[model samples]
Target: MALSSLDEVRERIGKAARLAGRRPDAVTLIAVSKTQPAPRILGLVSAGQRVFGENRVQEAEEKWPAIRERHPDIGLHLVGRLQSNKAEEAVRLFDAIHSVDRESLVTALARAMAKSGRRPDCFLQVNVGDEPQKGGCAVPDLPRLLEQARAADLPVAGLMCLPPADTEPAPFFALLAKLARRHDVAGLSMGMSADYESAVMIGATHVRVGTALFGQRGTEDG
Candidate 1:
C-alpha cells in the first residue's frame, strides 16, 4: 500500500474542508478496501486509518472477520449493492451501510436489526443523475425511501451517491446536501478518490477514497 498516499489524501481532505469553512476532522475518510488483501489493510490501519469501505458482503466476510478480531476499533462500511437475502449478514458485518436504496432492503434490514439487536448506520443512496444502471433509489423516491427506513426503525444516518461518472460532481453533491437538510438528516457519504476534495468542500460528512490511498484496484493484492 502507498503510505504517503494516505497522508496526501488526508492533507487534501483537510485543505478542502478548510476551504469550505468546515472542520477537517468532521469529514470521515472511508478507505475503500474492496479487493485489497489483509496485509495492505493492516498497513493502513497501522497508519491510523480506522474506517474502511467494502463493496460486497461475501468479500468482506472473507477479509474482515479476522481483521476485526485484531482491531476491534476498525469500522467497516458496505458501499455497494446489497441483496435482501444478505441483510442479516450485512447487519452483523458492517458498521455502516451506504447502499440502503430500496424498500425491500429497508424492511429486511429492520427485521435483521431487530433479530440481531444491532443497527448499523444506514445511508440511503440517491441516483442523483437518474442513471438507470446505477444502484441508488431514484431522486423523486428518496423522501418515501427515507420515511420507510425510519418507520422500519433503521438508523438513518444520511444520504450517499455516486454521481454520473466523468461529469462534474459538485452540483450533485449540493443537491444531496439540500435533500438531507430538507429531510433533516445529517450524513452525506459521497465522493471518491477523483473528486473527494470537492465533496468535502460541499459538506460531505464522509468520503470513500480507494485509488488515491490503496493505489489501483488489485495491483497490490499480491
Candidate 2:
C-alpha cells in the first residue's frame, strides 16, 4: 500500500509538472512524517522515499538520529514553527528548514550555522493569505527579511507558504512563485496533501505531503 501510494503521488507530480512544461524531477515530494512511527517511516524508506519533514526539533531528534544511522541517505526537513532557542539543534538535525519567518530566527540560525559550520537549506515562509494566526513572514516585510537573512549568510534557498484552509490555493501558489522570482530565489516550497497538483502547475519546487502517502492520522499507528 505504501509503495503504491508513493507511486501514485509521484505519477501525479510528474503529470502536473509536464502540464506546466517543467521536469518532474524539478519537484521534490517531502513526506510529512511527524507523528508517524519509525516502522511506518521505514516502510516508505523501503519504497525509495528519502526526504521527510518533521514539525518539531525534539520530535525529529527522538526518531531521525536512529533512522538516519541506518539509511544515511535520508534527508530530514524542519517544516514547522521553529523557536529561536532551538536554532542550534535544528541546524544540526535538519537538512532543510521550511519555516524561516522572522528576524530573530534568522539571527539565531546564523549564529548556530557559524558555530557548527552546517549550512542547511532555508525557505522563507510567507503568509500569502495574510492569516493572522499563521506562521510566516508578512508579504510586506519580505524584502527586509530577505535582506537580513542574506546579510546573515544563511542559505536562503526559497520561499514557503500554507494558504488559507478551504480556499482556492492556486492564487496563493502563484503569488508565492511570483515572489520567489521577484526575489531571485529559485525554490518554492508551497503545497500539501490536498493542493500539491495545483501547486505543481504553478511551479512549486517542493511539495510536503502526509495523508496521501501515509494513512489518516492515528489510524495505523505502530
Per lDDT, the best of the predicted structures is: 2
Q: For residues 3-101, write the lDDT of model 2, one tens digit per residue.
A: 498999999999999999999999999999999999999999999999999999999999999999999999999999999999999999999999999
Q: Give the TM-score of candidate 1.
A: 0.96
RMSD (Å) per prediction: 2.7, 2.6
Residue pairs whose backbone atoms clash in candidate 2: none
lDDT for each of the candidates?
0.92, 0.93
What ranges in model 2 sit over 4 Å off?
Answer: 1-3, 218-222
Residues 1-222, model 1: lDDT tens digits = 643988999999999999999889999999999888999999999999999999899999999999999999999999988999999999999999999999999999999999999999999999999999889999899989998998898999999999987799899999999999999999999989889999999999999999988887643110
Please estimate how well model 1 matches the true structure, expressed as its whole-model Cα lDDT: 0.92
Q: Which runs of model 1 end up more than 4 angstroms from their true locations? A: 1-3, 218-222
What does the lDDT come to for candidate 2? Answer: 0.93
Give me the displacement of residue 160 in model 2, in angstroms: 0.3
CA-RMSD of model 2: 2.6
